[model samples]
Target: MKPRTLAGTCVPLCLLTAALNAAWAQDVPPGVGSESASRAGGNRLDRVELNSRQQSDTELRRKSQVAKQIYGRDELDKYGDTSVADVLKRLPGVNVAGGAPRMRGLGAGYTLILINGDPAPPGFQLDQLNPAQVERIEVTKGPTADKSAQAVAGAINIILKDAPRVSQRDLRLGLGYNVDRPTPSATFTLGEKLGPVSVSVPVSVFEWRSLNESVTERYAKGTDGQPSSITQQGEVLNWGHGFNTAPRISWRRNDDETLNFQGFAQKGQWNNRVRYNNSLPVGMPNPEDDADNKGSWRMLRGNLQYNNRFSDSQSIELKAGIQDARGTFNNLNLRSGLPRVHSVGDNQDRSLTQAGKYSQLLGEDHSLAVGWDLEWRKRDETRTTTLANGQNQLPDFDGEPFGARIERQAFFVQDEWEVSPQWSTYLGLRYERIATSSRGGSESVRNVSSVLTPLWHINYKLDPKGRDMIRASLTRSYKAPDLGALLSRYALNGKYPDSSVTNEELSPDRVGNPLLKPELATGLDIAYEKYMNGGGMFSVGLFHRRITNLIRNAVTLETPSFASAPRWVSRPVNFSRAQTSGLELELKGRANELMPALFDPKTALNLRGSVSFYHSRVDALEGPDNRLDGQQPWSGNLGLDYRFSSMPLLVGGNLNFTPGYTTRQTQGQWLDQSRSRSIDLFAQWIFNPKASMRLSVGNFAPLDGQSVTRLSAGDFTRTERSGRSWVGLGLELKL
Candidate 1:
């Protein structure tokens, strides 16, 4: 969340920027030389060790059979002031407005979240996760057929680290505080080696607060492309806490195979407060729609797997998992303390997935990999509210209102074939079967669906370890209708012509229409990467794709016969098609200290940056006027880092720059002034092996960072999103 006080926001932002400019002053991995480094490999019984880069959290999350995804992590500190939303914004193709994370330049409804490889979005998902305990984050940077049948843009997967190992007992504590927020966290790992048996378990607790002051709007429409928004300014705060625990037990059954079992549990909760004052008439001077948002979720999961090495050239592993989750949302709309307004709702979800993968070593120049995936899921929800005393709040369009339920199942498989020492090829296929039903609740629509897909990838190595190489892929994918599409109430403008009632059940709406085909996509991509001997790398790529059955929202009107309600119609319809393609380039590496290039073992310099340019054209938009959508025509980030390890303590800083781009700015929902660009800076110091500190500042001058919008007489514009500058400080200890 953005800070509240003017000084609080400006002061820290400046400090951070300054730090970034003077970076190249810090340290590297702790204890790499003195501490014993375990050799990476598996024991005869399948016990394995992973190197730092191989087990990176970033790559893990992006691993959907296909579709590219990315992520970033915020280092923990003594001043534990970290926001999940804030960290998410530093990632690619992700931005948050009004506390909602938009992925692939799309809305919330399109992206999906997963927990430890499971498809699940628990309440407090964004607010309550403990950043300190996150081992790493990953993204699927490509496309795959077996990934999903419903992923319109693509897929994202998050893999949590396996339980830590313990010999006796160990405890970890972290505490941090910024002028505006505080963080408290604890973690403990325990383990013991008994004869031939080894057991390990890790537990963590985290709590933090997020607060921001501002006003935001959802969407703005029309040809001019303005933003949509109005001032109902206020202060908001969120307090979140959560924990995770998992245990691992393993036995060396034999020389050829090993068995392992894991039990895990996770829980999170967050409370939010939003107060706004809208401008209006006396009776509605400012609608006081204060809401107390409280959410909680719980999960119990287990994993069992067996590994077998039949020979030196091949190996196979079989694994299965089971999970159960229930979520609760108690939302109350109010117009003051007088009476509860219009909404009270609750939801619950459950799912299970199982699969098996195999790897075969074919001589010294080749290898093969293949796998199959399967999953099933169900959900339920209940909503209760009062409209105008006598009118009912909801019952979906078909007239049922208790809740909604659904079942989805999918299966997929693929193979990776290595053709030679420098070349590799991949191919895959996936299929899904889905059935859904609803009654009395917003999710009530019964529909059945299925999809088939084929995908492939080819890689060439120009240099060793894939340092200089090119990769190309072709993929076909699809997305099915979600809950909102089949269940919303379709309507017409109440103004004049044919202003009539339009129920979602109307034939044109396809409420229960099972004939609706899935959204399909075809894409071609080419990428090249090169390693610069100086510890950095450069990469560039180009891609193009076509999408059919794309769902979109458009305005529909009748001849002054519509009902006395709202005008616009919001539903799922496969209107026009979309063609998108772009160019991406990235350069990152350690700065050289020697070639006037100051390079040293004690103090090191690093440079990292990426740029993206996309050309999107709309051929068949349902709207009368045809034009391109407004995302960014060109955007990217560049950072420079400096670190010094010579002192008893280590210090370093980094600067990040992102130039702004303009869209056809709209009004109302997304009104805002044009911001040319933005930048942030930071510096960090390690007091010792066990202690560290960080300072961050953002948006100095020329900072037309537009995050706030305003509504004028008719044309809407916006104030700079970021103020002059803001500063933040943090500290951390490993004891």
Candidate 2:
């Protein structure tokens, strides 16, 4: 179905569901819907009884010194989302593209991801993480001195569950269906408290299978000025299984001192099979006719923290951690005339970190904090490719090993001061330094960079009760080049050597530049918030960023040291300056509180909606379609939930949409993407408070297909792909 038709169908169904539920609620007896009603006397429970999570989330947001959005257990479990990416897509001003999360319409690397107040390690995949293991999610719109200043757009922090104060046990069993088969999943959580020690462990195992269909068309002109075209249709089968566990132990020596340990481990494997057929073969044969691929990855991390307080006004915290990760991949491809091509790759990474913070409360209005962070990381990688006869595909770099190391240090200080009953301010400064070195074959490079950033935030309360406020911030942030972008190594194209006979602009060789500099940004943000009774809020925000020394891949014809002939090579370079701005608006509350004329004054209905607009431009690019890469012009989300007054069930659904947009990649290249839409629905039945079951459907009315078009000077390529929706049913038990 078309995207617009699907959206039109799903939105009304959601509103109809809520309207029907509200009508039924109007028939409920007055005393039965009151808070003090007795269940034994056949009285229905009040809507307030189901608002614990909402109340807690709102209170936390209201009391925070920094402006942020918090999502608790309710948001995590409401849609029965299996992955963190799915959960984040419903948030305002956030989008998930290619399994990575983006904020304010900016692409990946603009948003910083953190786990438990620390940076997420390399090779972390948000889609592999289960929501059950998370306690809450925090999203900040700007940079802060206490953390890294790499957030040019924003930051997202995932807080893992901690040791509980009471002993508890819980189990979850689930089954999901996609294209061809049913997949199974299970999770178990245990928590215990003994004297001064507390322990908690949560483990989850899951499996998935999916099928995707794709069609590709390519058009190009030959030396004779004759246009040629080729069309290929293909199918891909993907299967995966994974397991993850999080464990925590806490020891409280006294009220003023504590020690804690947190550990996490994950392992997973995936397999893929592809089959392709040429419907119209008018040009040279394709290199990737049929393929088989398999890969495996694992990660382990452990952290220890200690905290102490010398007096009512003085406190300190120390943290140390170690992490190890590894991955391997193997691929086999069948060609038309040549022998089968086989490739293998392996990579390993290790890192260590230490951090500390000291805080003191001065006379009545000011609180000060100082902190430092230190980290070291190393990576080793090896890759080899050969024909069936054991002949090296690219003889120059085949079977070669590469290594890289990075060292980082940072120090920051911040103070929060209350100037009066209506005004509060935060002032901060941070200094950071990074050094990197890499070696491979006959190439070695080293680079060092340092930055000093200053940040300020001001909050003004419009009312003495502090229920309404305005917030403004000005900060400096930077995006540093990743290890791969800094390493001076050459990566050849698939099944092709660095020769002019087969090289093309669209299929270019890749190399890194060691001399690249970090991209720095100056930003401003303003927001207004109003808090209402019963966990309701209305907010609008605006943000702008001006970035210097923007990093973008530039494709050009060059003869590198590794290649004998002039070939098309794409390299990362700091080429231009850019700017981006956006406006965000969000409203969420009980339906009756938002629209008392339409809904009953005490109806058990809830509503949430948000819309955002984004605009950007690159100073070096041409006019019209010169927006930031992968950024949509606008996006929006609408969601609703209703509880039946006659039954022990709750139903909710959400609709998300992103309009299509085109991006001007370079002087001669342009990229276009199709609109994206998704509709998710869930129903939960509460069988007493200790047992429950949930039924969920994700992407209920999946679009028939999505298309992408890439246009370059005499060449054009377009790809369209389609996949099926998924449904899951799960049961939960608590003891």
TM-score for all predictions?
Answer: 0.73, 0.93
| lDDT by residue for model 1 (1-735), tens | 344445565555476556534532444443334322311111111111111232232233222223343333322221232445445554555555555554444445444555455444333255344444444444444545445544444444554444443364545555433335546767666777776577877687877665545543322332123333344555566677888776777877678888778766778877887766554222211223566678777877777877888898788877677776666655555455543444445555555667666777767645566666665555555544444363444333222333333455555566766676677777777766666655543333566766667778877888646557787878776656554344333322111112233322111221222234566777787877665443345668787768777665433423222244334443446666777677877765445522334554323445556777666544563322122334455556655545433322223333334444443222222222344444555556544546655665544342434543322234332332323344456554544
Please give the RMSD of candidate 1 to the true structure.
Answer: 8.3
True-structure RMSD, every candidate: 8.3, 4.5
lDDT of 2 by residue, 214-262 (tens): 8888776432335667787778889999999889999999999999999
Tell me the number of clashing residue pairs for each predicted model. 99, 0
Error of 1 at 186 (Å): 3.8
The models' CA-based lDDT, in order, is: 0.51, 0.82
